[model samples]
Target: MEINIPKGGITITKLLLRICSILIIIALVTSVDGSKGNSASPEESITILFTHDLHDNFLPFEVRRNQGKYTVGGYARLYSAIKEQREKDPDAVLVDAGDFAMGTLFQTIYASDSPGLRMMGQMGYDATTLGNHEFDFRARGLAASLRAAKDSGDAIPKIVATNTIFPTDDEGKIPANLQALKEAMDHYEVKDYLIVERKGIRIGILGLMGEEAASNAPMSGVTFDDAIESAKSTAATLKNDEDVDLVIALSHSGTSDEKSKSEDELIAQKVPDIDVIISGHSHTMLKEPILVGNTIIGSSGEYGEHLGVLNISLDVNKKWKVNEYKLIVIDDTLPLDPTTSETIEKYKQLIQEKYLRHFDMEFDEVLAYSPFDFTPFSEIGIELKEEPLGNLIGDSFIHTVRELEGNDYEPIAAAVMPYGNIRDSFGKGDITVSNVFNVNSLGIGPDEISGYPLLNIYLTGKELKTVAEVDASITPIMDEVQLYVAGLSYTLNTNRFIFNKVTDVRLQDFDGTKEEIDDHKLYRVVAGLYSAQMLPYVNEKSFGILSIVPKTKEGTPVTNFEDQIIYMNGNQEVKEWYAIANYLKSFDKIDGVPQIPVYYEQMKNRKVVEHNSNLFAVLKSPNRIIVTAYAILLAFVGIVVLIITLIVKRRRRKK
Candidate 1:
């Protein structure tokens, strides 16, 4: 991507002037792109325009907060802002930390042809790292997308992903998709580090994916090396092999707690020589560049919400020092660039004609009205506790699947969805199809469709309740992974043993009928495809301490649960957002709009919190799992008492 340094003769607006005075202009001078030391004095400065987690929000939209309504963040606004900054400092490098894809409907066709990457390339991104979300389409998908982008002949930026696990072992069968990905990674020249001479100074740039990001990218078939180790090795290569003056690490690791395992800040502390670390993956918005030793760490927030501008100057000692840092808001206040807007519209039209038209859906068509927010993280948020929104979704899943299937379909005892699957919350206004799309945007079906299918599985009542127990236990460890169940309400005794937290499991029906959950009875359950894949992993992630299994209704253990996955319609996987939109539209309209029933405006106590007033209360209505745990505890106590009694008898005999 080429940078156009505008001449001073160009017209400047008041907002640009204010931004220049407040955040843009810097006293320091530095040259951009080519040869070490030629024109600029040591006092000159260089600029780095950074953005992260854009997530395909190329159009500006209004966010109605409780305080007020404000428009924020789009390609046009961001382009205008970046152009203005470049006008002042022509040598500024535009780079994104990571996670620039796989959020919106635009990303649905990424594997075929990635418009997002093309747009970024057009926007003049100097370089960017591969974020966790980049792997959303899986190994072959990424390979295909990269190939597609290259084949498109768009001026895409340098995509650097250091510390990847290449997997060279020939013992077992390697998947074709994975093999294709490895080849594509090599063919595309996805590098660990690159040296670009900015003005007269050699700038060494390296990229690393953090541990969390690696974990999040389960579908990628690519594992990552240690973040610190990757950064250190790359820095060493750059400083020694390349002989660069400044070293920058575009780290998707992110700043985190000081003692946390591997974060951006930890990388900076461990790897000393990196000049600046642009952090990502954690979605942290650090307003000012954090100084750790000599390195400056900066991160902008997620979803094109903000742009980070970092200005640095060379000191007398020839060391780089941060002169300014701004996490500039990409709100409606900024003017839209006509060229970028035109490009964005072109893509939108293409998406409408090629994609949405098939489903009779428009990008911004209003589908329903929400009297209150149904967002995953709103007040009475689904993840915060058992919430109304979750209940609504769970109920919706059951309804949609049942309708899609014939009347003779096996009765589902309950339908459940993980809070992680529900992405965005609904605002207290008109809910558009796009809004619904935002809520459950992450999934792809077996048929290569855009959404995950709802799968039918069966589990013993004991195991079913255990699924809820997994929610209570894993919530603190994994944010938003908690399950929101529909068929039953389980009381959680926090004071009880970790894996044995849920109790009082009761089967609940849509008609409000309830019954005790039978321990031996196998009941049919429904879950989103993503949630189904994760069910087997919960026990593995918990170190096999919590043995969770979703069996068939006959109680036959499902070794390959993927085969059991069911589409709601004939060859049509359950598209979550579509299901949600259809469900909402099914609601009886008020004022000619399908108004949300007053039923969902508050919490739904699917999982009741039972504060253990005593040990007995904590262990009440113990399922087999809880009973076994309690027995073990009692046995341990009995053994201790027996030992104490023996010791006392011996002392008495001695006396």
Candidate 2:
């Protein structure tokens, strides 16, 4: 076919071609830079206000940093920040990533009063996910909390857990407590995903438990599917079946600066359809939004230290673009929400009446007054060193154990507390009973109580050295494994081989006297129930190189940690928090307040690290592990050299 055009005039076909080219250019420009072209689909925005790893901080708490005590975080202030954002954008969606319970004294009533959930409701959270800490009291407690929240007639946030699997028996029926949990979930309308329309925007939100989060919740009794796979399937449904315009993931999975370890970032990279992800679990505080393709990932710091505000607006291509993102610091400057404050106070009273009275203590009873601040919680695991706070807690364990055992007391060689278990540190002021509890307020006892009970185990001196080696080695890879001891001291040379970092180990008295550790002798060790339970797993974490067998005094391997619980009075479990509290109360009083002595004001050389690079220090006392590592390295080098020589000879012959 032939088309003819007049001299300088365009034919019908030419005119149509020109118009199509112009449209194509306009579309490309619009897609490339949203600001370039004008599209009929005007931009619309949706604001998301989020928090994670709140850990039941219903009231403002003190944090000692930079030689000063600063008051920060509380539900009331968090709600005030949320209200401010909502006022600016009424359609803003409020969400939490998880770990809403089990940190403060408020968690004492988690199963009974459901304060965490009810308070989130009052704060107007639209949706939330479950973090590992939510299951700290185990499945039954979680079920009870859910039931309590539902029965209270409070408007709790809708929960969406896409990957959380409720295990079934061989008969395809869930267990009793799990069944109860399932029923509560059903009653509360927990689902894989939820769809909400706000200001003409349809948003789909789904929640997921990350790999690390799931691993941390060993007692959760529920398993989780792969986060990426669950997210892929759920996002597909939200986009294809629900026909939603936006997909937001409320992932308890966390982000890291390292792409290999960042769970949520991996999810975004694998699942492109997800528009936004609210990350939690690691308690990361991203200063700015992380944009993966078109996806925006945001995380607020833990303990409600900050509230994340993510603003997204639709671009010319009908894709979401981040307009603004900021984390509002929840500090004393923010005015507290009156109703929320009152509700929290009511929960406090409930805690005092129902929980505190059992221990014969008031909510704010002063246990001791510290003249100097201990180690700040933020700096606890940053470096592998002796921490004054750890020293105090470990000493408290020994003190309580000795006092409880009284005449039956066997010398406690050491009491170990891992950095992971130390939740908070005391500032320079009156340390109240609440302060002591908050420091070790993790895990539940066999009595289904809030705190982890103390337990006694015996470790051979050889194994104790291994514990020091584990701290010196494993802590670099996993900081939570860092161990602090009350009656033990060890020196480590950092330049030594990986697992042989500890060069010296000894048992030290609190009075600064050192005693040699007999390698084959059994030493009684005291630690929190949870820490003792985790001691056996160190072998697995260390890949069989190091083994720690926690045994009874009669040399029987422990299977049930509950049986080892150290009791104070007849069947009353000696809770870890109470041990610290009792130790504080025993301190000499000055002017009616128990005074923490200056002894704890400095590090006690429990963990002395020699960071020398001298050849002698680096090569000093190579243990069996180091010798094996060297042999392996030499064999590998010899094989490589032989292969190179063979290759050169073969090439010469060919030439």
Candidate 3:
């Protein structure tokens, strides 16, 4: 099928073919020279503006820290900071670790728009990991959030999770929840690792959720691989196969008080090939970068209080090094990105139109006044010991439950707050309803309310002692379960034998009266619904070393705690924030306005700590749990001694 072509046409075709060959050769050379098509050196320096554990703090908050008041955090301010950095160095990237969702009213629309991700997309986050809170609405909810983010037609970040071990054919039936999550992860191109070429620098990025974080996500059906192993494998792939110049691990594993237990630190030490680890979940603020072998790790504190800025440069040998590390404090002093501010306001309007309007709540209505600061982050706060903040919250629960449940509610003996549920602090100055909500931002029961509803239950005084015991024994493992009580005081001897840490438990009265708790008496107690459900699992978590049994004031056993849920405010859920707000409003007006009492300025001694764990000291007020714990310890020691003795005897006989 040969067709004769004209002489001029053939010459034109030959010239075109030669031009095409020359263009292909030039493209190959340009690619090989690492020329961002400019024949420049491949050595590139990058600046990273990183944040973690944002937890939906869309607006700057006026917070009192270290006896000073300042406004901190907000996407508007962060966007401006990121913008400045990017303008300075075009190679700069904005990234986050995880938990960018599920903290504020904006989280209510997670299943639809996922305004958090959308706003991040608008702010230009290059990539982000999934924190436990991202799955707070469950797998289906996460899927919807991702779908909405994609549908918005916005330039969204490349999401990644390196350690998610998806179910396989050999793993049996995949649960519907996990299947949905897997599909979303796939659709969003969430890979084990990503190689991004930014300004001639190939950066390898991987995301990980640590065991502690996985523990927090009880509803997330996905299983995660070991952080250390997964990180090492992914980093190796990036280095050996992809030849990336930098390996970055976005870890939601959190920093630990002990280096031995810290997940990110451990990864850094074990996987020295990783250049940087932007850690989250622990809410740790490291002023200086932690150097573990060749890797450097840093974490911005929880919320958007600070932006982590890191500069990385390559040495002559092409090995990466952190040139500078700074935790840039986000405050009102920083310029607000107008575009981002508008984006935030758009979500606020969405909150008003979609959810808050129905509840008759405005985002910034002043609810009360605080003359002093109250933060769980303090040394004596709920996260550690019982501070005045804990006392006020506990008392509020008692008062709110009594008012809403009426006389039939059997008078709550005390209200308890798990430290995990207390999110933000009450800063000195005008306390708005939003501020109150921030302090108590956590949980949604089956009713789908904005906050966890207050629940009342009855427990024997003996069970109260068990609760104290659990606090002492299990708190080191699960700090979130540390209980802050109102109307109760306990002296803890931390050095005492395991499961036998509390030395004294007494009932505290409003006038500072102290009386021994009657173990046989049944007393009503109040707690958030989520904490109430978790109360029964203490024994299981402790491997049956501890136990708790919730009951009714009538001495009847509680089979289904949910069935006994009492709705307040004419069938409205008595939200925790409302209880706190109502309680704050009840305070005496100081300076012609209701203010937090001056009493919180000083320690209330709710938890008197005596480190005397001597045998005599521990035996002072031993309850049944402590007595049993001692017996078990002694028996185990005796058995070990006997086994050794028998082995020695057998060895002597053989000899």
Measured against the true structure, the TM-scores of the candidates, in listed sequence, are 0.89, 0.89, 0.84
Task: Kindly report which residue stretches of model 3 are placed more than 4 angstroms away from their true locations once superposed.
Answer: 1-43, 63-67, 168-173, 240-243, 380-384, 407-409, 476-478, 491-504, 512-516, 541-545, 552-556, 569-571, 588-593, 599-606, 611-618, 625-655
- Residue 286 accuracy (lDDT) in model 1: 88
Q: Cα RMSDs of all predictions?
A: 9.3, 8.4, 7.5
Which has the higher lDDT value, candidate number 1 or candidate number 2? 2
lDDT per residue (tens digit) for residues 157-259 in model 2: 9999999998889999888878877887888788999988786667899999999899999888888999999999999988887777889999999998788
Give the Å error, residue 366, model 3.
1.0
The whole-model C-alpha lDDT of candidate 1 against the native structure comes to 0.78
For residues 461-523, what per-residue lDDT tens digits would candidate 3 score against the true structure? 888887887878788777777888887878788777667788788888766788898988998
How much does candidate 3 score in TM-score? 0.84
| Residue-level lDDT for 143 in candidate 1 | 89
Off by over 4 Å in 2: 1-41, 64-69, 627-655
RMSD of 3: 7.5
**Stretches of candidate 1 exceeding 4 Å from the true structure:** 1-41, 62-66, 170-175, 375-384, 541-545, 612-616, 644-655
TM-score of 2: 0.89
Ranking by lDDT: 2, 3, 1
The best candidate by lDDT is: 2
Alpha carbon deviation, residue 458, candidate 1 (Å): 1.4
